[model samples]
Target chain A: MLLTLGIIGILYVGILVLLALRARTDVKSSNSYLLGGSNLGAVIGFFTFAATLFSTFTLLGMPDFFRVHGIGAWIFLMISDAVMVFGLIWIGYELRKKARKTNYLGMSGFLELNYKSRFAGIVAFIGVFIFLLPYIAIQIRGVAIFLHATFPEALPMWAWAAAIVAVMIIYSEIGGLKAIMYSDVLQGILLLVAIWIVGYNCLHHFGGVTAMFEEVEKVNSALLSVPGPKGLFDFQFLLGSMIAIVLLPYTQPQVSTRIVILKDIKSLHKMAIGIGFFAILVILPTAFMGMYGAVLYPDASTSEFLNMTFISDQSNLIGAIVMIGLIAAAISTSDSQLFALGGELRSILKGDDEKMVFLARIGIAVFAISSLIFALLTSDELVLLARTSFAGTSLLAPMIFTGIFYKNAPNLTVIPMVTLVALIIFVASLLNFIPNHFLGIRMDLTLLAIMTLFALVCIYTDRSKRGGAIEN
Target chain B: MTNERIWTLCKIAVVILIILTFTPLVTPSGIHKPAFMGLPYTLWVGILEAFLLVGITWLATIVHSGRHEE
Candidate 1:
C-alpha cells in the first residue's frame, strides 16, 4: 500500500509540475496568466468547472452528509447542482455579456466598474474573502484529517494541511489558471474513477441496491427518508441550500470567472449541460457509499467512516488511488479558489497591468497562507461549513446580479451599501451574537429575501425618479 | 414556437420543478416506499428529477437565444 501510494503520488506531482511548466510557457501577458486568454473550449471548461465545484466536499463531505442526513442530501446537493447548471446557461449569458463590455479581470472590479463606486468593489471583495477562507480551509482540513487517519503514526494534521497548501501555492504561482485547469482535468477523472470503484464495491456488498436499502432499513429506516433522524433537511434548509447553490456561479468569483472565460455562448451552454450530468454521475455514488455507511459504520466519525470505507475496507491498490484522488480533489478546488480571490484583488487595483498582476500573485500567496491557518482551526463538519460558505457568498448575489442586469447600476450605490449591512448581520448570526433564525426563518433566507426586495425597489424607484424628471 | 418563447418555457419548467422538489411529491417526509428498480422512494424520485433537470438544460441549450452569440 505504501509503495503504491508513493508511486501514484509521485506520478501525480510529476504531471502537475509538467502542466505548470507548459502553462508557464504560454503566459505571455497578465491576461493570459490570469484568465487563460479568455478562450476556453467546452470540454475543458466542463471538466475545470466540475473539478472546482465538486471537490473534497463531494468526495469526503457528501457521503457523510448522506449518511447523517439521509436521502434528502440528494435533494440538498444534486438537485441544487442540477438547477445551478441550468442557471449557468441562463443568467450566465447575461453576466458574460455585461462583463465583456469591460476589461474584465475579477468580480470585485466588475462590480466597481458597474456601480461607479470603489466601495461597492470593496464590499464584494470583503464578502468573498470573509467566506471563502473557511471554505478553502475545509478542503485542506478534509483531506488532511483523512490522511492523518490513514497514517496515524505519520505527520500531524496541521503538517499535512501545510504540505497540501504549500504544494498548491507553488504550482498555482508557477503556472496560473491554465495550470489549475489542466490539473483539474486529471483530478476530475481520478475523482470519478475512485468514487465509482468504491460505490460499486459498496453496492456489491449487499448483492444489489434492494438488499442495500434493506440492510439500511434494518439498521435505521430513517436513513432512507427525508430529514433522516436529525431532522436537518427541513424545507427551509433545503430551500436556502438550493437558492445559495443556484446563485453560486454569480456569487462565487471562482465560478463566475469560468463563465466569462468560456470561448463562446455555445461552449458555455454545452458546459452547463455537461455539468448537470456530471453532478448526477458524481453525487449518485456518494449516496451508495453513504447508504453503505449507514448500514455498517453508522456512528463513526467523519474521518473514521471515510477512512474505513474509502481505505480500510478496500484493496491496497484501490485505497492508494482513492487517497491520491482525495488529495487531488482538495488541491484542484482549493487552488482555483485561492487564485480567484487573487483575481478579485487585481480587478479592484489600479496600476500598470504588470504591477497589478504581480501584486495579485502576492495576494494569492497571502490568501493561501490564511486558508492554511484556518484549516488547522476549523471544525470537521465539512458539508455544513461548506454550506455556510455558500450561504455567506450568496448574500453577494443581489448586489452582483443588480450590477449585471440593471442598466443604471452605477446610480444605485444603495444596493452595495445595504449588501454590506446584510453581510455584517449574517456574520453576527454565525458568531451567535444573534440567533441564526429571524422570526422562524433562517437568517440567510431572511436576509437574502430582504436584499432581493430592496434591490428591486431601488431599481424601480430609480426608474420612477428618472421618469418624473423626464416628464417635468 | 420561437426559440425565445421556448427559452421562456424552459425557465418556467425549471421553476416549477424546483418548487415541486420542496413539496411532498418529491420528498415526502418519512415515506420511503414505492421503490423502483429496488431503489427507495425519494432517492429514485430525486434521481429522476435530476435527470429531468439535465434533460431540460440540454434542451434549453439547443433553443437558447444566445447560442449563436460569440
Candidate 2:
C-alpha cells in the first residue's frame, strides 16, 4: 500500500515537473509567467484560488479539529473562510484595478511606489517570509505525515519531504505562476472529487452526522464547546483566530498575487465567489469526516482522528485517493507560498530582474529546509503547532490592513504596529498567560478578535488621514 | 466611497461582529450539532463564511457592469 502511494506521489510530481518546464519557457518574462499575462479569466482564477484556499490542512486537519473541539472549531474555521471571501471580494477587485492602472508588477513594487518608501516594500517582503514559513512548513509537514502513514517502509519521512519539495519546485521554477495555476487546476479537481467521496463514505460508515455526534458527546462534553480537550482555547484565542480568518487569505503570497494578476474586475469577483463556494464545500466535509470518525474511533486524539480512523480506516485504494487529495493540497499550499516567497524575496532588493528571480528560487529552498528541521525537531502537539504557527503570522494582519485601507498611514508606523501586535499574541498564546477560555470561548477565538480590532484602528486612522489630506 | 464600498465595510463589520457574538458561544458542542436550516453548522460554516458569497456577488456585479473606470 505504502509503495503504491509512494509511486503515486512520484507520478504526480513528475507530471507537475513537465507542466512547469513548459511554463518555464516564458520565465524570462517573469510577469507573463508569474501572472499568466494578467489575462486569467474566471475559470483559471477560480481554480487557482480554490487550490490556494482549500489547502491540505483543511483536508487532513479540520476533521481532526472537529474530533477534539467538537463543532466549535467550525465557528472559528467557518468564520475565517467566510471573511477571507469577504476580503477578496473588495480588496481583490481594487487591487486588480490598481495594478492595471499603476503598472504595479508586484505587491512590493506597489508599496514602494504608493508609500514612496522602500522600507514599506522591505517590510512587506520580510513580513511574508517570517509569517509564511510556518504556514508552508505545515503544508510540507502534513504531506510528510501523510506519506509516512501510507508508506512508512518505502522511504524516510525526510526523503518523502524531499520528493514532494522537488516536484513542487520543479514546476514552481519552470512555469512560475502559470505552471502552478495549471497544476492547481488539475489538483483542484482531484481534491474536490476525493473530498466528497471520503466525506460521504465516512458519514455513511458512521451512520450519519447526527448519530456520530451522540457518540462524540459521550467522549467529552467539552468537545461541544470552545475549549474542547486540550484546554488551549479562550477569549484571546477566539479573537486571535477571528483575525487570523480575515488575515489568513492574504498571508499566502499566491493569494496576494491574485489581486495583481487577475485580468479584470468582473473575472476577479467571479473568481472570488467561485473559490468561496468551493472552499466552504471542501472544508465543511472534513469536519463531518471528523464526526464520522467520532463513531468509529470515539477515543482518538484529534490528530489520530484525522490521520488514523478518518483517513486510514478505508481500503488501500480509497486511502490512496485521500493521499492524492492531500498531495494536491500540499502542492497547492507549497507552490503558491513558494511563488509568493519568490516575489517577497525579490522585493527586498530592487535591481536586476533575473537576479531577483534567482534569489527567489533560493528563498523557496531556505524556507523548505527550515520547515523540515522544525518538523523533525518540534515535539509540539500537531494541532497546537498549527495554531501557534498561525500566531506567528498574526503580525502581518495589522500591516496589510493598514496598507490596503490606510492611505496616509505613517510610513514609520506600519512595521512596528504589525510586529508588536503579532508578537504580543504569539507570546501570550505560548505562555498561556491569556485566558485559555474566554466568555465560554477558546483562546483561538480571543486571539482573532484582538487582531481584528488592531487592524481596524490602524486602517481607520490611515483612512482618516486620506480624508484630512484631501480636505486640506 | 460608493455604497458598494460602504456595503463592503458593513459586511466586514458584520462578519467581525458575528465572530464576537460567537465569542460567548465558543464552548464545545458535539461535533455533529445541527445549525439553522438543519445543516450541521460545522459542515455549513461556509454558508455564513463571512459574506464571502455576498461580497463576491457584489464584486462580480461591479465588474460585469463595466461601471469601473481604469
Candidate 3:
C-alpha cells in the first residue's frame, strides 16, 4: 500500500509540476483562463474531450456493468459514444460558427447573449450546477470507495474523497482550464495504457480473449449474451441513454468548452473522429476485464469483484499502477467538472476579469467541498448515478439546440419556462414523486420528447409572428 | 465534390446512423441467433456501425476540408 501510494504520489506531483510549468501566469484576460484562448490543437483537443467524457466510470463502472449486465452494456455506452462522436462533427461546426458570431464565453453566457436575457444564462447555470455537482461527486466517490475497499487500513473514504477534491481544486486553480486539458492528455494516455495492461493480464490468465469468453459461457451462458443475467439494458433504457450521451457535449460545459476551444473546424472534425476510435479502444478492453470477472468471481459483489480483479490478481507493482490509473481517471474527470462549474459561475457574474477570476476560484473551492459532501452522502452506484446526471442535464438539450440552430426562438421566457417545468417533472420522477418510467419509456425520454415538442412550437410561433409583423 | 454536396451527404450519413440505432440493427434480437466472425451478430453490427461512422466522418472531413482551400 505504501509503495502504491508512493508511486501515485510521485506521478501526481510530476503531473502538477508539468502543469505548473505549462501554466500561463501571463493570462491577462478571463478568456485565456476560461477557454484556453481557444487555441487547442487536434491532439490535445481530442484527448481533453475523450478524458472529460470518460472517467473512473470507464475503468470501474464499465467493467462492472459489463460483468453484471452484458453486451447490452456495449450498446449502452460504446454505440452511444460512437453516435455522439458522429454528431459532434456537425454540431462542432455549427457551435463554433455560432460562438464566433456571439463572442461565446461559456454555455450559460452563450445562451444569455443569444436569447438576450440574463435569465436564460442563469437557468442554464443552475441546471448545470444541479446536475454536475452530483456527477462530480460520483467520480470522487468512485475512487474513494475503490481505494477504501482495496486498502481498508489506509484511509477513510472521506479522506480519499477530500484528498482528490483538494488536489483537483488546487491544480485547476494554478493552471486553470489549460492545466486541466494538459493533464487530460496525460490521463487519457495513462487510462488507455493501464486498462490494456490489466486487460491483457486478465486475458492471459484465462489463456486468451476467446478462451475467457468461452469460460464465461460455460459458467453462465447468460453472461455472454445481451442483458446478461439482469435485464437492465432494455430498448428504452439504451435509447434514452444514447440521446443523453449524444447531447452530452452540448449540455456538459466541460465537454462543450473543449469543443469550442479547438483551433479550427477541421481540428474539431479530426477530434471527433479520434474520439470515436478512443471510445472503441477504451471500451473494448473493459469487456475483457468483465469476462474475466464473470468467469472468476461471478457471484462477488461489485466492490469485491473490482478489488480482486484490480488489486489482488495482479503483481504488486501492476496493481499499484492500475490503482493510480484509477485515481488519475477520477481526478482528471473531477477537476474538469469542478473547473467547468467555476467557468459557469464566471459566466453568470458581472464583474471584471480580476474579480470574476477571484470569485470563480472561490466558487471552485465551494463547489468542490459540496461535491465532497455529496460523495460522502451518496450511495456507490457509479454508472446509474452518472446516467441520472446525464439524463438530468439532457433536459437542457432543447434549450441549447434551439439557441444553436434558431435565429429567433419564441419568447426567450418560454424556453426557460419549458425547461424549468421539464426539470420539475424529471426531478419529481427522480425523487419518486412520479415513476421513472411510464409505459415502458423512461421519464427522461418522455420529458425530452415533451420539451422538444414545446421548443418546436415556440420556434414555429416565433416564425409566424415575424411573418405577420412583416406583412403589416 | 462541392462543399454543399459533401455536407449534405454528411447530414444524410448522420440521419442514417441515428436511424440505425433506433432500428433493430442494434437490438439483440436482430443479430442474436447468428455468430458471424466469432462474435454475437448484435455485437459485431454495433462495432461495424461505429467503424462506419468513423469512416464516414473521415471521408466527410477529407471532402469538406478539401474544399476549404478553394
Candidate 4:
C-alpha cells in the first residue's frame, strides 16, 4: 500500500507541476492570471466547474451524510444541484450579458460599478471572505484529517493541511487560473474513476442494488427514507439547502467567475447541461458507499467509517488511487477559491493593472495561509459546514440579483447595506450569539426572505419615485 | 410558439417541479415502500425528479433565445 501510494502520489504531483509550468506565461496580467483569459469553452468549462463545485465535500462528506442522514442526502445535494444547473442556463445568461458590458474583474467590482457605491463592493468582498474562508478551510481539513487517519504514523493532521495548502499556493501562483482549470480536468476524471471503483466494490459487497437496500433495511429502515434517523432532512432544511445551492453560481465568486468566463452562451448552456449530468454521476456512487457504511459501520465514527470503507476494505492500489483522488479533490476546490478571493480583491482595486495584479497575488497567498490555519482549528463536519458556507454566501443573492437585473441598481444601494446586516446576523446565528431559528424558521431562510423582500420593495419605491419625478 | 415562449414555459415547468419536490408526493416523511427495482421510494423518486430537471434544462437550452448569441 505504501509503495502504491508513493507511486501514485508522485505521479499526481508530477502532472500538477507539468500543468502548472504549461500554464505559466511571461505576462502576468489580471485577465490571464486571474480570469484564465476569460474565454473558456464547453468541455474545459464543464470539468472545471464540476471539479470546483463538487470537491472533498462530495468525496468525503457525502457518504457520511448518507450513512447518517439516510437517502434524503440524495435529494439534499442532487435535487439542489439539478435546480442549480437550470438556474445557470436561466439567470446565468442574464448575468453574463450584464457582466460583459462592464470591465468585470470580480462580482464585488461589478456590484460596486453597477450600484455606484464602493460600499457595495466592500460588502460583497466581506461577505464572501467571511463565508468562503471557512469553506476553503473545510476542504483542506476534510482531506487532511482523512489522510492523517489513514496513515496515523506518517504526518500530523496540521502538517498534512499545511502541505496541501502549500501545494495549492505553489501551482496556482505559478500557473494561475489556467493551470488550475487544466488540473481540474485531471482531478475531475480521477475523482470519477476512484469514486465509481469504490462504489462498485461497496455495492458488490451486498451482491446487487436490491439486495443492498435489504441489508440496509435489516440494519436500519430509516436509512431508506427522508429525515433519516436523526431527522436532519426536514422540509425547511432541504428547501433552504436548495435555495442556497441554486444561488451558488451567482453568489459564490468562484462559481460566478466560471459563469462569466465561458467563451459564449453556447458554452455556458452546454456546460450547464453537462454539470447536471455530472452531478448525478458523481453523487450516485456516494449513495452506494453511504449505504455500505450504514450497514457495516453504522456506529463507527466518521473517520473510522471512512477509513474502514475507503481504505481498509479496499485493495492496496485502489486505496492509493482513492487517496490521490481525495487530495486532488481538495486541491482542485481550494486553489480556485483562494484564487477567486484574490480576483475579488483585484476587481475592487483602482490602480495600475500590474500593481493591482501583484497585490491580488499577495492577497491569494494571505487567504491560503488563513485557510491553512483555520483548517487546523475548524471542526470536521464537512457537509454541514459546506451547507453553512452555501447558505451564508446565498445571503448576497438579493443584492447580486439587483445588481444584475435592475437598471436602477445604483439607486438601490440600500440592498447591499441590508445584505451586510443580514450577513452579520447569519454569522451571529452560526456562532450561537443568536438562536439558529427565528419563530420556527431557520435563520438563513428567514434572513434571505427578508433581504429579498427588502430589495424588491426598494426597487419598487425607487421606480415609483422616478415615476413621480417624471410626472412632475 | 416562439422560442421565447418555449423558454418561459420551461422555466415555469421547473418552478412547478421544484415546488412539488418538497411535497409528500416526492419526499414523504417515513415512507420507504413502493420501491422500484429495490430502490427506496424517495431515493428513486428523487433520482427521477433530478433526471426530469436535467432533461428540462436540456430542452430549455435548445429553445433558449440566447442560444444563438455568441
Predicted model with the maximum lDDT: 4
lDDT per residue as tens, model 4, A1-472 = 9999999999999999999999998799989999999999999999999999999999999999999999999999999999999998888998998888778899999999988999999999999999999999999999988999999999999999999998998899899999999999999999999999999999999999999999999999998998899999999999999999999999999999999999999999999999999999999999999999999999999999999999999999999999999999999999999999999999999999999999999999999999998888989899999999999999999999888778778888888888999999999999999999999999999999999899888878988887522110
**Where in model 1 is the C-alpha error above 4 Å?**
A26-28, A468-472
- Looking at model 2, residue A110 earns an lDDT score of 62
DockQ score of each predicted structure, in the order shown: 0.90, 0.29, 0.43, 0.91
What is model 1's C-alpha RMSD? 2.0
Candidate 1 B-chain TM-score: 0.96
Ranked by lDDT from best down, the candidates are: 4, 1, 3, 2
Q: Just chain B of model 2: what TM-score? A: 0.35
Writing each residue's lDDT as its tens digit, candidate 3 over A48-132 gives 8888988988899989888887667788898888778877776766777677665666899888877777888888998899899
- Candidate 2: deviation at residue A239, Å? 2.8
- Residue pairs that clash (backbone atoms under 3 angstroms), model 1: none
TM-score of chain A of 2: 0.85
Q: Write the per-residue lDDT of candidate 2 for residues A173-195, one digit (tens) a residue.
A: 66778888888888898888888
Model 2 per-residue lDDT tens digits across residues B1-70: 6755656556666555555545334232334355544445433443554454455445545644343543
Q: Which candidate is the best by DockQ?
A: 4
TM-score of chain B of each: 0.96, 0.35, 0.74, 0.94
Put down candidate 1 lDDT per residue, A280-392, tens digits, no spaces: 98999999999999989988999999999999999999999999999999999999999899999999999888888889999999999999999998899999999999999
Predicted chain A of candidate 1: TM-score = 0.98
Clashes of 1: 0
**Rank ordering of all candidates by TM-score, starting from the highest:** 4, 1, 3, 2
Task: Please state the interface RMSD for every predicted structure, separated by commas.
Answer: 0.7, 4.6, 3.3, 0.6
